[model samples]
Target chain A: MSNYSLRHLQELEAESIFVIREVFAQFENPAILFSGGKDSIVLTHLAKKAFWPAKIPFPLVHIDTGHNFPETIDFRDKLVENLGARLVVGLVQDSIDQGKVAEETGLNASRNALQTTTLLDTIEANKFDAAMGGARRDEEKARAKERFFSHRDDFGQWDPKNQRPELWNIFNGKKNMGEHFRVFPISNWTEMDVWQYILAENIPLPSLYFAHEREVIERNGTLLAVSDYLNMRGDEVKMTKTVRYRTCGDMPITGAVESNASTLEDIIVEIAATRMTERGTRADDKRSETAMEDRKKQGYF
Target chain B: MTQSGYLDMELLRFTTAGSVDDGKSTLIGRLLYDSKSIFEDQLEAVKGSSQKKGLAHIDLSLLTDGLKDEREQGITIDVAYRYFATPRRKFIIADTPGHIQYTRNMVTGASTANLALILIDARKGVIEQTYRHSYIASLLQIPHIIVCVNKMDLVDYDQERFNEIVKTYEAFASKLDVQDIRFIPISALEGDNVVNRSTKTSWYEGSTLLHTLENIHIGSDYNHLDARFPIQTVIRPHRQEYHDFRGYAGRIDGGVFRPGEEIIVLPSGFKSKIKEIMVGEEKVSEAFPPMSVTMTLDDDIDVSRGDMLAKPNNQPDSTQDLELMMCWLNNRGLNPSSKYILRHTSNEMRTMVKEVIYKLNINSLSKDESDKNIGMNDIFRAKLRTTKAVLKDAYRKNRNTGSLILVDEATNETVAAGMIV
Candidate 1:
């Protein structure tokens, strides 16, 4: 027995780095599913560290829902440029234009679910055998049972019941020609862990996470940002409110919370004292009981 | 903001195995509730689901029963990960079900665990479930085993009953391979001996379950004596600054290695000196097991993934024949005639099952040599013949380097988890 020991964050970082290195070693064409969120940014940072001295051996794939917060897009492009990594954008609008996917009709509709079609199509087009996502198990129930190396059918649908058994640190990436695998390196990380790591590593994030003044409308007790992507036909009055986004997603579905935590330190304090789950404000998850599961079954990230 | 103290906290990963009646959910709920891990939205959602199901109170079991089918079927199918952190340490709970593919789920959960929490109903004493749970924990070589005797309230918090259960378990544990074992009487339902010291168990002198988990000495769990580094990938900058940079990247499976140390590359028998070990951009003096780092050698030698580096005097065996204790994980039985791909660490080789030594009946905790027909959730000792020599160690020696998994090529499914003899 030796006195040398690693902290929890270091251990997690090591595990994540190991998984990323495995992806680079095992898969033929792998890509990071970057959503411009804090999780994805942290994933990219870890991936960079995993193959330092050598560039990250995979492209960063962003499934563009065409309704993203402008800051997310700018930040994504800048980060990609700084990392010297290739960025592949899959547009949901392109799928809609090609009649491959139809847009939702009602006002509450979002391009969130439609990202599945574009994402699968992008994976198929790029011939990516493995798509690394930053989704944590603590986020959703169905995700809680996800294997670190998740297998998807040829149609890209995840069969939660029939996942391959992953043992120890050994991951089996073997799959059929058309079948792809979705690997989550940070499957064990919680939201607090992610925030702590981000702060510890001093990783850069989009400005939307910090508190700022924005015109938003109150709907179902949520502050919806007034943007072109969001509909304003309802009678809800729009007012300027200082809010910060917990999760970065499309404008219509991603809600903001009013807070004074503009810095990462203050955000951590707020998160520590906060009672609600980060995804509680997500309108997409509020749709149904098994919303994430339903979409994940249809090959959603 | 309060930050630096939490950074010093180490991680303690433990798996909890119990049946529905063992009150596993109650124990987990109490732990999370005491630590304030469950968020308000999560509880609200659970409450809403409980109301929708017409339940009078919140079903904490719903929180652990993950996936749509599991909720619908009223049983856990796979291992679900749950997290909670106290001021002293952070914990990851691999909450595995006791039945319905118990072997597969428990093995997956126990593979990375430092401890195993085997729950037993105080009223039931030592049942078959207890035997199965303890057996899996022992077989997986979990460093710590805490037999949590739940439902002590139901047994009137009797010390004699607890002592009797512990004696019965001790009789059974003699057959197991585990060493560090402890007992604690807990009433998860009544929060007795769970978080705080219970007044009912004034006769009990042991620490509470939460205290035990928080203060357990897990620093020595890793193998820091045998330096075994299996290369997962090669790092080549091919850039301007570091043009000739060629490094072997891997997580140390065992022991430690430092610069200027003599090492031998497996299969090639090429001797080289460790020039430097770099974790990301910074060079470290030494590296140990579970730390991912890139090491550069003095001599220019061809070393790639699946190759292992170790001290010349103390090296792992590279052999084509492998004898292992395998737990069949898939629905399909272990087919001796079927060609399977054996994955060990970063290495993969075509392998076939030569023979089945024996199958252990998990229920009775006895070996059944006559029953050679192996199926899912069946743990058996078998001989495997690989197409190429694999660098390996005994499972009890180095868990990272000594274990392997067999993948079914046709269906592309992981069929078995094997621990080397």
Candidate 2:
């Protein structure tokens, strides 16, 4: 008892709760940039703990690419209902329809990069002074240098070279009008930490992360789930296999891993021994060596 | 059994600071690389980068340089945080650069660190830069200081040279306020005493860097004498199950707070008794430093962010002015009259550096009272006046409430690291 301190999950929770409350206290209007993924779900869960007696004083803002998994959307709706928090979605379909953004045309076409424009636009339109995210530094190389409270200029550009010096737990969330900040509450957490925390906290996640029999096609050494978002090519063969997604993104780019790790315990064991990183399955990051860095520079959360 | 392995784990954050080209990055890289924390793909990426540069070997320093531009330039320009864990403890390494220009980065890295790892080149011995690093460590109230005499391979693992350098450092460090100091001689490039024991230097019997980190006596580092919990938010679930539950959610800043203990709120001077302490349904008997728990009082009292709850008899000094040892980090000089935001604990207030008392000559370990201009990479003592009164304690007494950072109002950049004197 005298030698006791917090575990990894508890420390992560404490640090994240501290970050979330700082965002709410510092920014005039802040929102959580939810992507309907496990990371975002964990962020929302931590936010719920941040302001317990009081409702989460901010809304869950999602930048919709209209290429999401239906199960993800279902999970989002149910979780939002359970927490009783407001949801704000910015539709890329509407941006395409309004001629705000043009849809890419190709076999490997994706709205992943286009979501940045919609996200910046949504942030500007809503006047969110601080936008909280679940981006972990250990997830990507560029994010490794990311500050907890990352400030953006009025033009919605991130200057990686000119970031604020974040010391201690003191986050300077000050920004002028038209300029805002992006806060990552779970910046220090790794993929394993997130899963372990989710399991420990009993946070409900989307069913896509669990094993299920689904028709999928193998392309570029990745198992792509068959959905309306993906048009099956002739060379691609579709078959049913027991698989669970290590990451959840749009159905087009997000890949599934061959695994029977359905339960949380199984998932933890699988992740503990897994060789590949969680982002290795996301084709969005593989588009280039610094795809995440490039998108982040243009204000992509 | 797998999830249960993380039942009781503590976190230790430490910083490594030294002069330029003292192999700070290599030491950290070796720690992570040898600990099996570096994944194969990450290692592959680093190896690929090293091969592209046409280096004879894989440059481990490339692992700590996070930014793309920094990697291309082959230097660490900012504070890059790296995480790893043994079964005993989790470690967060604030990998800071040692360049004179990046002094602000060092200050930022050392602000929240519990320990400071000061590296010394075996050839250079105790140079002027080593003194600067030690002074900053002492000023920051970093409880433990581990001075690693690196590059022993270059010195042929000479014990005489190690003894002479240790004596020189001890003579200089005696003037500072550092409480704990330990010395180890290692060759980081040869993987000596970083993660594994070195067979080359059998004379050194101290624990390796990893062993020292895992088994350091950190339980006494926290201030258990005075409990300080700053309320972060109010937690209330309006559902049927927790309809009437009102909890003050916060991270315990200092000391231990137990259930049913008599506590008093600051500024308001209101008193109450702790009704319950809840951390996710497991009712905790007591909460200490760094634990985030919600405490409901027996009586309803007004408490919000920046408000502190502490033992009634043991209270922090409420003051508007403080004397601080500040390390100027930015190229922009200190603004003596201009107001900047000061963040201490959960409280934020506007502050101004009223006077620069004296600047320390890092090389000589002497004070230069004539110098008043605080410039980049300069360590100086100054008086700061804040708009609002802050609950304060000596940095040596309570690290959480005693330290602060001065932010630039225009740029929102943290300009200086302040430790109450």
Candidate 3:
């Protein structure tokens, strides 16, 4: 037997780095989609490792929903500054203001879906041949069938049925003019894997991930953080709770779970012991059975 | 406890092949559910969908059929990946459809998998789909094969029926080139010999499917005897501190390399001694297969992407006339006169199909010498002449350096997957 066996996390890390390097080599212009989430944080860290002694070859693209937690934006800016990597923010507010996308109304309104338009427009404006995301197959049912180098048409639409067969480590990123690709470096990672990786790497994440005192309101059995983006409803009463977000997205739509897991080690334990998926608390996914699938078809990351 | 345990766990990626009626999705669903990998919300969603369909029992297949058209048609049209982990190992299942029409999808899924799970219905013993799947597994050179004889409960959990199916499969599998083959009688619906051992299967002495998957010896799955590193790209930081630092970055395909080892850069045939191997700022003494690292040479030998670094004594063949087993993946048929782009490792070059050897009949394990037309899902041996010489090994020797893909230049679609012979 060879004395070269790596731990599961190490193997996954190496695989992800290989994919990130491939994107750097294959595409003329590629950017890592940074949402300040744990997955994207790990991806950006991997990109740093992929070209160590050198800066990350690609810029970090953030499709700012404009409804994000202030802590997330602060963390995103700080990380970008620390790494000396460029940050490109595509604003959903700009898209709405420019009449490219209309804002949702009523109780469960969110700018989450509108970010796709800003994202596509940003890719077109920048002419990014590949936009790498931190999407994992274990995240959602619709994402399970996603390719590592997912292809997008000229309109940035995903055709799940006619996806190219990704064999071995050979990723085909070939596309015509005006078309682009969505490269997922960590497509094989599970939620548990991501947490375990964060713990192993000591990766810094946004403060929203850890337990904190925050004002929240319960809606549809989920605790929504009370922020400027959310309007107070008549029957919904706000309360203070020590909770942490399982996933980071728009403030109004992204839900938080009451937890005492403050440290990375504590968070890993909490995730391992939990029965609900990370996306289970997100109100946007509960809109329909194929909500994520529908959104991805329309170019949502 | 979870953190420490996760660090010791190994990862195993396996592919499953089964027809629509063979309960492939059910088997996967049972594995995930029994392992507690399925979240409560996911199960609740599946239950709601099942109620909407007015079905008495929850359709486990609905959990795997992800696409909208697939859900509407009640069949899996493409490959869907599923992940689950236990204390011992992490498992990634590449679930592919098993109809004769979707053989290309099966091949694609099996390409990266360490093991292939061939599902056979107990009622129908060994059928054509079984042969077809097994053949593809062998062609892809998957290291392990697990013949899962499912639906034993429908056959009254009869040991005799299971043994008969196992015997027929063994007879058929003997014709293939798979190294390790295990047979297990499972009832994916009743949860027999899948995750938990069944009392009804007490006569069987084998381990459960989950246990086998966890304990399988996969340490020697990679090619560690011959060192092969194809540079993905060069990392030249123009920073002031690292002005003179140049590193060739890529994942090691095979074997091990240590500092001061004499290595030869391929195609250029220039020799250099390794100065250091870096894995993200930390200097490692040695590097091996699948570990993406940066290597700095003692001498700058003009190495770039698509170039290889191997031990001076041990080297792969640098050849232009390549003979390989090709599985056509696109709807467009192979045109002998037209040129296609051949992508191997990090290298891409234009190539032409020189000759079409006999097409392999997957069902009968026979070669049809007369039918030279290679269409979608057709596996054939062919000679390809590339514009540039590529470093390669036989498909059976090293999978990473031995495999290549043909891309249709006009559409830029991956047309075929080739295994270098």
Best by lDDT: 3
CAPRI docking class of candidate 1: medium
* CA lDDT, candidate 3, residue B224: 92
Candidate 2 chain A minimal-lDDT segment of 10 residues: A1-10
lDDT of 2 by residue, B209-259 (tens): 899999887777777778999887677677787877888887888888889
Query: How much lDDT does each candidate structure score?
Result: 0.90, 0.84, 0.91
Q: Residue B234 of model 1: what lDDT? A: 93
Model 2 chain B weakest 10-residue run by lDDT:
B1-10
Clashing pairs in 3: none
Cα lDDT of model 3 by residue, B273-295, tens digit? 99999989888888888899999
Candidate 1 per-residue lDDT over residues A1-301, each given as its tens digit: 5456778887888899999999999999999999999999999999998998999899999999999999999999999999899999999999999999899977788899899999999999999999999999989887888888999999999988788877899999888889999999999898989998888878899999999999999888888999888876667798999999999988998899999998899999999899888899899998888989999999998
**DockQ, all candidates in order:** 0.67, 0.50, 0.67
**Could you give the DockQ of candidate 2?**
0.50
**Candidate 1 reference-contact recovery:** 0.77
Q: Which lDDT tens digits does candidate 3 get at residues A158-205?
A: 989778999999989898999999999999999889898887777889
The TM-score of the first chain in every model comes to 0.98, 0.98, 0.98
For model 1, how does the per-residue alpha-carbon lDDT over B63-99 read when each residue is reduced to its tens digit?
6767778777787778899998997888999999998
Which lDDT value does model 3 have at B198?
A: 96
lDDT of 3 at A75: 96
